[model samples]
Target: MNNLLQINSTDVTVFVFAGIIVLALLFGFIMYFLFSYRHKQKDFQLLHDQKQQIDVQKIELEKTLRELKSTQAQLIQQEKMANLGELTAGVAHEIQNPLNFVNNFSEVSNELIEELKTERQKTESERSAGTENDIINDIEQNLQKINYHGKRAESIVKGMLQHSRANAGVKEPTDINKLADEYLRLSFHGLRAKDKSFNADFKTDFDESIGKINVIPQDIGRVLLNLFNNAFYTVNEKRKSASDSYLPTVLVQTKKLNSAIEIIVRDNGDGIPKKIIEKIFQPFFTTKPTGQGTGLGLSLSYDIIKAHSGEIKVESKEGEGTTFIIQLPIL
Candidate 1:
């Protein structure tokens, strides 16, 4: 009976120890789960914060883009206004010559009319022999001068109209020779108007076989004018340091090939240095002094030619001269 009692007590002690061990294990598992859940929550918060930051950056980038676009628009508008102002000044300067001729001729014609009227009022006996014929000849000369001035004014107005019209990249059949020749003379006259003593030997070799090629007339005209203007400006600059015997000359030539048309504007003046020949077409790169060059002229010309599927190149020697060659496909 004592043995049986001892066994029962031992079994009860074992049961109590086993229950304590199970409780300890359960507590450890609950603590581990709690810590793991907290860690996951912290990670979630960090991820949410990063996403917010990215969203804010995206909004800021969009705002920056909007601002950039607005600024670009403003810059383009300013450029247009500047171009308009330049065109206005050029037209006004060019028209002065014809207007002066008209004014002077009008005054002379009026005087001649008065003189003829006076001679007519006088009796035939009082008037000297051939006086009437002399008065008639003078009046005819004045009328011719007035007519010539009127035609010149008309031509200037027509040219200005064509230049002002915004016919962007519209190609049409154009007489390349005529276009080249016209701009050559126009540029020379423009320089002469700016400086009374400016004179250059202008020459043209137009290929009759070139016929007509499809092109943007106004754009090409502007290109020619820019090139001719540059050529004239170069020669004139050279003339300043050159002797009186130095005759500034500009030559324009056109050639028709089986597949392409080539136009060349060459000058005998101070040439472009080799280093700068590459940068002449870059925007805002100019060899001229401030207020003398915008530097955008050649850049714009390059862009225009590129748009037309053509190529423009320059050849120069340091002390000789520069030649600009333009080649356009026959398509």
Candidate 2:
């Protein structure tokens, strides 16, 4: 009985040891699986983070590309303007010589016509009185028309020369009144030349006390011309849809201050909308049709005013009128 008990005890011990080995193997397998799963999860998270960073970088690149394109376009526009300025100066100079000749000869021809008329009148006879008088009158009328148009052409050429001059970059003592009046008439006549029936009630009130001011006349002239042109164009557009009783009027006035000069250009025309008023001075912003305007007028004028240590502002009411106020230092 003792031998049997010892043998049974030994068998039980062996069974317990085998069971322990099985459990150890099972636990090892579970740990290996958990570690492998964790490694895969970490890799997937890292990939996700890298993708997000790439997306952000792509967005930034796109923004940078857009800004670069805008800058490039502005540079191109500036280059084009410079080239156009050179071309305009060349054309104006070429036209100026012939224009002077035309004006000079026209004046001389007018004097000769008057002298011929006088001689014909003194030698008048009943034999050919009616025919001779009619010929002389026709000649005189033709010469008068020629002289008038020649003067107009000369004025236009002079304006072109002034506009193309490089003197706009320099400041000199200038007659403000004379400059304003000269440009006002030039702008009006330029419009008239384009549209024969275009007319406006123009008024001016210049302060004589303003006297001479040190300024870049060419630049200021350009600014004034731009303002006048806009005023005329606005009123002309309004006239198209307005009643016959509606008379378009543009008024220009100047005032002398202690240390500054003020110019006000007002027009009875369709005024600017509030939403777009702020954008008027921005480069390439314009209300005019695509081909009718380059949109640089106000922008250039604004820069010019700044360069002169001056200020420009606008006041407008829809359907009533618009006014542009420019203030320049007396210096």
Candidate 3:
């Protein structure tokens, strides 16, 4: 009977040990589940917060984009105004010549009229026949001068109107040689009017063989004016720091081809640097100081030429000079 009791005690001890191990495993599982739940909750909250932050940031980005667009519009308008101002300056310079001739000839004609009136009052013997004829001839010439200049001024005004008025983008037969010459003088005189100290010598070599081609005269004129302005600006800038012997000069030449024409503009100023030469045609790329340039001249010229199925390129050597070549197809 004692041995049977000892066996029962040993079985109870084994049962108790097994029960304790099962309880420990249940506690371990509970702890693991609790910790995992907490971590998952924290991760979910973090993601929710990040999503809210991203939404707020997106709103701010949209606002910023709108503001940027508004600023861009303003700048574009400013650029347009600047272009109009330059063109006006050019027009004024061009018109002044004819106006001056008109005034001077008017004054001379008035003097001749006064002389003829005085001669008429003199005695028949005192009034020489030759004197009347000479005065009449001189007055006729003066009248012709006035008529010519008045017509020139009228033509210039008409041209200004044509440019200002809105029209369909139609190509017309344009004499590029004459167009180039006109703009060169216009650009030079406009610059001179703006800056009294500005002075430069210019040379032109126009190929008379290249007759009128179908083009938008106003557009091509604009391109030529821009190039001429840039050339003059470069030469003028160089003149400031250049030696006394340095002479600022701009050269414009035209060459005719069977299927194309080349307009070459060269300036004896500090040439463009090699590193930035390739980017010259890029919009908003400029080497000029702030407020000095809009950086749209070359970029616009490039686009205009490309629109007309033409090409424009630049060549430069630092501290020497720069040249721009424009090739336009004979379409």
Overall lDDT per candidate, in order of appearance? 0.81, 0.78, 0.86
lDDT of 1 by residue, 210-320 (tens): 888899887788788778888999999999899998989999999987799999999999999988899999977889899777776788779778977999999999778
| Residue runs of model 3 more than 4 Å from their true location after superposition | 1-80, 87-90, 122-130, 163-169
Quote each prediction's TM-score. Answer: 0.64, 0.58, 0.73
What C-alpha lDDT, on a 0 to 100 scale, does residue 125 get in candidate 3? 80
Model 2 agreement with the true structure over 1-331: per-residue lDDT tens digits? 7656445877888999989998999988999998998999899889889989999999999999999878755643553344235335333443455466566656666666776666666744524666557656766666776666567666656755556654335788988888888677666766765677788878999999999999887778878878988998899999989999999999999999879999999999999999999999987788989766777788888888999999999999999999999999997
lDDT of 3 by residue, 67-161 (tens): 98787656545554565567677779788889999999999999999999999999988988899889999999999999999998897777656
Best by lDDT: 3
Scanning candidate 2 in windows of ten residues, the lowest lDDT window is 82-91
What is the alpha-carbon lDDT for the whole of candidate 2? 0.78
Per-residue lDDT value at 135 in model 2: 57
TM-score of predicted structure 3: 0.73
Cα displacement (Å) at residue 225, model 2: 0.8
Best by TM-score: 3
Per-candidate clash tally = 0, 0, 0
Relative to the true structure, candidate 2 reaches a TM of 0.58
